[model samples]
Target: MAIRDVRAYIEEHGLVETADEESEKSIWRKSGFEGVRSFGEMEQILSRFIREHRDARRLNRAQVGIMVGLHETIFARYERAFSKLHVTRLIHLCEILDCSPIEVVHAAAPHLFGDNRKEADDKMKLILCILDMPALTAASLLAMIEGLVGERERSGD
Candidate 1:
């Protein structure tokens, strides 16, 4: 199904309130599951994506909830089940993981997977742009990111 059809399904399922145009629009625009084969497929896609991001920011239950727009309890309750994750939340989580939505879906589907996440993450973190703190000296290099007096500001932030 295309985005329009996905939106229609959500509307039919009463998942989107008529008053919340933004939520409705968000589902269509950002949902990674659009045209995906099944909820099982959605689950596989997000699980691997989360695994890839498990080290960064160390997403706690609450953080995962925020990323997926589900309640903390909901996230905790469903953390193990791939079928419960929403497509919209999956896409948003990919953004947080600094990966594309396509990557998440591909990662989930073993049959279609091409990239090795561990390798990619290692390489991605090596990129200068990902180094929040550029340590110019041995002393600075010893400093952990949280130890930096000035939280290195992101370029656009």
Candidate 2:
């Protein structure tokens, strides 16, 4: 169904406040993201991440488009931020590029992953290191982390 139809259905069912009752600006302010990057800026960042991943894989836009079952021009629109990249489409594109959605999100908004930019970068580096490790070594690291988490939970941390 079209977005408008879905919206209308939701409003009709009182699932959410109508736009008339809650403006977009109010919603944004209420969401506590007023000073964060704008949607357009985030979109551009995500688009750049997509392009970089494609380049790193040495694959052209057309090749990625074919793999993701989108027309090259349509995919280009996403890269140009002319069209919004839906989450499902992002996941599909990440799959085609042999990358994870979390990686793309972290690239776009590292601040979401940690208390500060440096912390986020360090976490990303550690995650990349783990990803590059041998399977057994990674498994051992996971076990250690799980044990630490269990201990923390036991202490009500």
Candidate 3:
């Protein structure tokens, strides 16, 4: 099962939220997902990250350009809060979580994009693999997360 499925079961069943990060870590391992919500929760988490992180605030493309050393308008295209991000920018974003592209997709949408649950179990598995990536330095990763979520939202599949 995919981690997405387990997460749904958790939410639908009202599984008591646990304080132990370790216990939280155990969710994907135990549930074995089957499918994910039609309206993905991945974006919600990404939005949370941007809101939680001071540096990740919404900036016009120009501000992001200043931050990432790119053409200001290049970043602006995504300012509407509904555009897919460029991959290069995504790499910059991962550096913040000390995370990887793989980690971001897994955490945010494992069932939709994970390497087949046979290979990927949970978001944590991916996070653990990239745990040593690097602490937040650039706002790129947040943007990438936003982009993916935005893309999913647009499709409305």
Candidate with top lDDT is 2
Would you list the rank order by TM-score, best first?
A: 2, 1, 3
Error of 2 at 150 (Å): 4.4
For all candidates, the clash counts are 0, 0, 7
Q: Give the TM-score of candidate 1.
A: 0.38
Candidate 3: stretches off by over 4 Å: 1-64, 70-80, 96-98, 112-130, 133-157
TM-score, model 2 to reference: 0.71
For candidate 1, the 10 contiguous residues with the lowest summed lDDT are 28-37
Worst 10 residues of 2 by lDDT: 26-35
What does candidate 1's lDDT look like per residue over 1-157, in tens digits? Answer: 4565765777664453222222334332222223323445456446655764754667677876787677877765444663465677667766766766555545554333324445554444444344454456534555655455445554333
- Model 2, residue 130: C-alpha shift (Å): 2.6
Q: Write the per-residue lDDT of candidate 2 for residues 81-100, one digit (tens) a residue.
A: 88889999999988888887
User: lDDT values of the candidates?
Assistant: 0.53, 0.78, 0.51
- lDDT comparison, 1 vs 2, better candidate: 2
- Model 2 misplaced regions, further than 4 Å: 1-23, 28-34, 150-157
